[model samples]
Target: MSTEGSVSNDREGHVKTEGERSFWGRLANWGLYQTLMTVITLSPRRQFFILAAFPILWLLTQHLGPMLQMLRVSLLDAYPVAPDVAQEFSLESYFKFFGDPIFWMPLFRTLIFAAVFTLCTLLITYPVAYFLARHVSRKNQMLLLLILLIPFWVGEIVRTYAIMILLGNTGALNLALKWLGLIDRPIPFMYTSFSMGLGMVYLTALYMLLPLYSALEKLPKSYNEAAADLGAGAWSRFRKITLPLTIEGISSGSTLVFLISTGFYATPVLLGGPSTTVFAETIAGFFHVAGDEWPTGAAFAVIMFIVALLITGVFQRLMKSLRKGESS
Candidate 1:
């Protein structure tokens, strides 16, 4: 009788345990279902955001996924993993790059030229942008902006090529020079660093000009007039009023010019002499032309990106300091 009772007790215990597990499982499923229903009942704005984010997320994945894949390939020992070489992660390529003066010299040269180009553009475009913003009538402003945009409508390659022809040995400028008896020879204008710098500025000057115009155009005219009425000289009024207000334009224009000048490769290649070596072109050669050197190229790219980030950060800090000084 006791044995039979114990057997019945065991069966009851098993049934109770099974029932508890079933109840918990149903509870978990109900919680998940409730969460789904709550999401369905979200506010219209929240629902719209959720829906809107899906496409953006998809696009990000599409781009970032490939970039991640490329980054992985760059980190790998070789393109094919080199089964016999015992593959492992290494910074050997970067080490090799940093160890050479050829790499360092070109990089410094590029930075210097890019700085000079940005400075020149800022100086050259500022007057035009200022005139457009302050002095020009509205009708003229519209007409002038349209004219300024004309060069951008034309392709960079075509513009650069046109420049090449104009600066070529037998091109229009040389012919004009010969006609004027300005020089005896064609003037060796075709392949030179000066040509490279000129092309870079010509192609990218609009970027700086437009930003300055945008910032300066929105200023309240009364502020400058008010300052002038208080006996502030024209230069003082400009230094104290116009400049502080248009700081954003200066930052934007400088940054745009700097970024473009640094990243430019084709212009440098087309217009530059053999001695003019920008790191962007060097990076391209390692990836596209050099044999089995893509890893080195990738390393170079990573370094350039970091360097650009650092430089931009420094510029931002400087701009902020200037802004603070003006505010005080």
Candidate 2:
């Protein structure tokens, strides 16, 4: 009878262990099924919308709110006295921007400066990029790149001041020239558009160089050799093969240089005089020198941002179309 009882007890223990394992297995399968169902039920569009909401919310909080507030104030005839104050919206700031040539002229000038600087940067960086990508050894390429980045290790303000010292009438260049008897008097190079452009180019040249280098580096030598084998000349090979391949890099770099150049404040302020005033300078004047009009400053900032965006979009689209043409 004792032996029979022992066997029954062992069977009961085995049954309990099996039951516990079965319960956990069912729970895990249910969880997996729920997850699969959720994924299968959501449409692509719905999933996209859900995923996009976070970024949209972030943008609204960070940018759109300030932009709307600025637009509201810019349209007001008079500044509000308090946070709760209400007034009718007017187009005074927009009218001021358009009707006054001072505001519009500076905007145009800024655009011109950015364009010219970008073009100059491209011209200067392309040859260096080509040499680094095609001719240089890997170790030397890295060393040369490091040399280019060395200037940026110093603060921008320090670099600008260094440029100032070098370019000033009584500065190092003038002293050296005078010592060499090259000129009778010190040349006035400071506080001019030339100086400002030089400074802008110096600051932003790396942006152009890096992208162009990256694009050129990825190009295989086989393409150039093939073009040569087909009886293509050097200029023809470069124009048809090399330039076409590096279009994406050129576009990206130019856009970055242009955008940064438009908003440049410190370099322009230090190197430029009255005639070389940019839109950023005007925005600064409106906020700090003038009666601290946050709304007007905000409006200017938004307009500048939109203009930059449009320019970038157009450039990217043009590049895309060109790429498509080349592929076809």
Candidate 3:
């Protein structure tokens, strides 16, 4: 009788354990389902805010956070300070940039180079974008774009290296010219302003191309057709209709390319000679040193950033006025 009683007790204990597990599992599921229903019942604006929380967090932490830290560092007298030393804030870092004239050439050159390169990119890519948007069948456009984007799939360093190989003395262009008897010797294409400019244009071409293509594609073909029907020539149609309408694309592409060109370090380093050194390299030189020079680099970076922004701001104003004039 005792043996049978113990067996019945074991069965009851097993059933009780299962009941406890089921109770907790149901509770967990209920809580989760209730939370989801609450979220679903939220207003659309609240839902949007919930969805946007991650991206806003990323922008704050990843983008704004680093810039703020850099600004703070720029104001400091030194970084990586002695463990017990107090921090000193000063403007001497900023003064160094103003006081030293050696940095002037690279700074000005970077601005000029960025502007020229951005314009060249615009001119070069505009035709290609126009053809892609206006001439090509819609079905093949994505395929063509994918083909064009193949070169950009690689990292910037790899692309810069490819440029180096292509522009080297005995590279394909030189060899082809030699084979054609066009030149007696290979021209030195590497380590020059021309090489740097070529690389900049190549790197920034996509930025210009996509915006122009978007603007061109979204443009109503009817506008140009109507102009043509009214006895407008091709150039006239483009000038009066296409160009005016596409000003936003030009502005956006130019701004993106100019800003990107100003900050390029790898392509310029690889393709540029001493005479072609840009402000970025100069700023990097400061950080490369062992000691308090880091603040100076940070300071110059801030200066370059501010100057670039001012130039773009002026460009934006001009573009906006042009847009207004075109619209009027």
Candidate 4:
């Protein structure tokens, strides 16, 4: 009786062990979750690449797929008819873009606004960043950055309305002017190029500041000291040493600020005059206002997309040239 009981116990244990193995085998055949966890079963290198590829494939489909479809639409005459009808895919929309000043004028204005906004933000941010990088201690730097980040914690629309309160005719700024007897009437500060530019600067300053601060922080103080020891003037040292190293920051900040500025819709529309219509506003109008002119809108968007690429290419070329000059 004792021998029989021991054999029975060994059989039960073997059956339980097989059940666990079978459960895992079934799980490995299940969908995404199991597959993800099964990465541990893969070799480390293969696991890492698979992990990286997942998000990259997802991003490409999410972002690039729509862009390609838009490009295709831009090449088609989908307006005035169904998008799938007897539409001869041609460059008429593009030619319309080139032929009409109305289409291209927004492009020009967008470029101007982008350039000015980027430049203004750079100028404003550089001094603040330079002071922080060169003067402040590490502990103090964190505190100051925290202070600077407070305003940006709010939403973009909230920040814009805050500017409106400051710049409105009967708003705080005007009230202050009245209190101080600075003017007899409120200045027109809310809806003009000046206001628009100021709004852009306020809205986009951080994009430029962070890069400048990072670049300047990484700069070695020894370069400046060495230049000074060689009797280099302040301006000379800055031009030769300081500026060269910070070029990456400047380019990165400028590119981001300019690209983002070109897409300004609400800020420019609310704060600027009719003359300051930008690419985003135009693109929006084509879709929202004129339902039939979607192809034209698509074409305008494609053109603007190319323009953005051109701006990026210009910056890249400049950076490459700078790198080459440094290398040589």
For every candidate, C-alpha RMSD to the true structure in Å: 15.5, 10.0, 9.5, 8.3
- TM-score against truth, every candidate: 0.81, 0.78, 0.85, 0.82
Candidate 2: C-alpha lDDT: 0.84
lDDT of 4 by residue, 1-328 (tens): 9878856765565487753345344455568757777765579888778778979888898889899878878887765566568866888888998797888898988888788888899999999999999999999998998899999888877888888888999989899999999999889887788888989999899999999999999999999999999999999998788787898898898888888888778888788777777878888888887666777898898899788879878986898689668646
Candidate 1: minimum summed lDDT over ten consecutive residues — where? 19-28
Please give, for residues 1-328, the per-residue lDDT of candidate 2 as tens digits: 9978866765665587753345344454587876975785589887787789889999998878876777777766666545677676766666667778888788889988998999999999999999999999988999988998999777778889988999999999999999999999999889988889888888999999999999999999999999899999999899889998999999999999999899888888899999898999988887774453655666677677788889889988998899879867
Model 4: which ten-residue window has the lowest total lDDT?
18-27
In terms of lDDT, the best-performing candidate is 3
lDDT of each: 0.83, 0.84, 0.90, 0.84
- What are the runs in model 2 whose C-alpha is more than 4 Å off? 1-59, 80-84, 289-292, 322-328
**Error of model 1, residue 66, in angstroms:** 4.5
* Candidate 4 lDDT for residue 40: 56
Kindly list the per-residue Cα lDDT of model 3 for residues 109-136, writing each as its tens digit.
9999999999999999999999999999
What order do candidates take by TM-score, descending? 3, 4, 1, 2
